[model samples]
Target: METLLINEQFVSQFKYWREGQVRTGMRFRRNLFEYVSKFNHHQRHHAFDLAWKLAQAGKESIVTATSDSYTIWVNLRVVCPAALPSWSNSGLEVGAFEPASPGLVPLEAVLSA
Candidate 1:
């Protein structure tokens, strides 16, 4: 439901979360959610902030933002419609969420397993 207008800029910067990779969870890092969510305003504010922080810390961060994680957070945000301003568009026309009929029906909802 929550939409992440991952512009070409952000996508271009994210060279790590490419296709066909897997994360096994052998990490021992700080809690990204707590740190960044304290400031950002969006559904995945914590997740997104933490991901960026992890990247800065030089950990194998691309895994933090696998397609699965991205999707889960985005969906949750959409459902809850968090108070984070980052979740919405700015300048009166930010190219982020495209409002739909009530709930956001996932483009791949049928495939969710």
Candidate 2:
């Protein structure tokens, strides 16, 4: 089984996004980069790696930013599955849950176990 760890910074940023209070595009980009960088350097999760690649490629579908505003189309729960329960209970769009790898266990399964 795989263990997923959700850091305080990830939870804080996720709350900001969930509340639609990300403020400016610059802030959003900065937070995204910081989270992705930290995850890559420490955890090396595939979801975060994918996010980093997409961000570097300037994928508008995942994120778009301007001087005043920004939009994040990516579902951050992919990189932070530990937040899935909170997201689902809050009636937010949790999106689909698919394990990044066959060896990776789903959050629901882990919780149920």
Candidate 3:
């Protein structure tokens, strides 16, 4: 699990995401998730970088992994001031398997997402 610290860059990302989500009527854009696999030290890094980006955008993102490492969960709490009244937190879960070797997770995947 990781927590993104709110800062100027984070605020900028947040604003951009929010602005893009606004529509003429009662519609919105879906959150983007551009993910890649990576290794942390020697372990498989199966977490999604979008969670951290969402956190930076004032959306609290919590990630959890089971003991067996077969499943992971992403829980999000969106509290942006520009959001609609009916908006609520979102969650996602994915199944994962251990890799034979390490993998690469790029920063570009997060920025471009």
Candidate 4:
């Protein structure tokens, strides 16, 4: 019964905490589901190892340890079509747009200058 509870907890965590992969149909989700189905909670301590395997295969990803409550290791990776925008000089500035402020500058004015 304890193992079942653990498995339930793991599934819940994976479903919600890792929703992105599951929703997007990423390979990681399938791999993890298979792992969970094949092994009990006691034998499923390879989240980091699996992440490492992905990274070693030349995939751009990230891995990190999860909260201490459950498993010792948890990894998260997100793959997008384009990580950044291709457009250059989009006239986006970090500071506020308050015209009254002397030092403040609007991106539009800067771009036009």
Candidate 5:
């Protein structure tokens, strides 16, 4: 499993984006780049970069968004196990896995147990 932690700063920017879209008469965009910038920008972060890359490569991920933060967990083992160690070394915290929804066990949690 590869985890990406999006800090509160990003969430604020995301809310701004949503409001901007509404004001511009554009439907709220769901593009990954919109939420997490890939180019140089104030909202850019390493976590966003990794998440974007994984998403582009068609890796499966679960996203959990809250007012405090946004978290993404990529199931790299099924598609690219060798890449796991590199992601693990990227300074992301390894916290207790929290299921994206109630009563659902993330595969990583099950395997780790």
Candidate 6:
């Protein structure tokens, strides 16, 4: 998810958010679906962990931690993908090294950036 976050930020001024199917087989309806569907297992794990924590806290709106924060919207990731792929369709795991890093990021950090 970190790579994805960076990728998205890197691609930020491009408006590629409206990006359509790279091929003829996939026709994504929403930008958020397209965005999250790209995350790998580690990313998904991190995302689910975050979502679970948010839901557990009784935060009714799962959009962004901040009301005006446009960084990410939870509803998009939570309910959009037609089928979640391993990682941005790249099929790469979050940690390929011998010792994997922790999967979860603090909510404060996620919300901060």
Question: Among these predicted structures, which one has the highest TM-score?
Answer: 5
Give the whole-model CA lDDT for all candidates, comma-separated: 0.26, 0.30, 0.29, 0.27, 0.37, 0.29
- Runs in model 5 deviating more than 4 A are 1-44, 75-78, 94-113
Residue 107: error of model 3 in Å? 37
Q: Can you give the TM-score per candidate against the true fold?
A: 0.22, 0.20, 0.26, 0.23, 0.36, 0.22
| Clash totals, every prediction | 5, 0, 0, 0, 0, 5
How well is each residue in 1-113 modelled by candidate 4, as lDDT tens digits? 00111322223222222223221111233232111111223333443344344445444432222232122112223233242122111332122111222342332333243
TM-score of 4: 0.23
Lowest lDDT sum, 10 consecutive residues, model 4, at 31-40
Q: Which 10 residues in a row give candidate 2 its minimum summed lDDT?
A: 33-42
- By summed lDDT, the worst window of 10 consecutive residues in model 3 runs over 7-16
> Which ranges of candidate 2 are over 4 A from the true structure?
1-7, 10-43, 59-113
In the range 1-113, model 1's lDDT, one tens digit per residue, is: 12233322232111111124221111112211111121123334545554454344343232223332331122221222233334322332213222223342322332241
Model 5 lowest lDDT segment of ten = 22-31
Clashing pairs in 5: none
What are the clashing pairs of model 1? 1-78, 2-78, 41-84, 41-85, 42-84
- lDDT agreement of model 2 with the native: 0.30
Model 4 steric clash pairs: none
Relative to the unseen true structure, what is the Cα RMSD of model 1?
14.4
Please state the error at residue 77 of candidate 3 in Å.
5.2
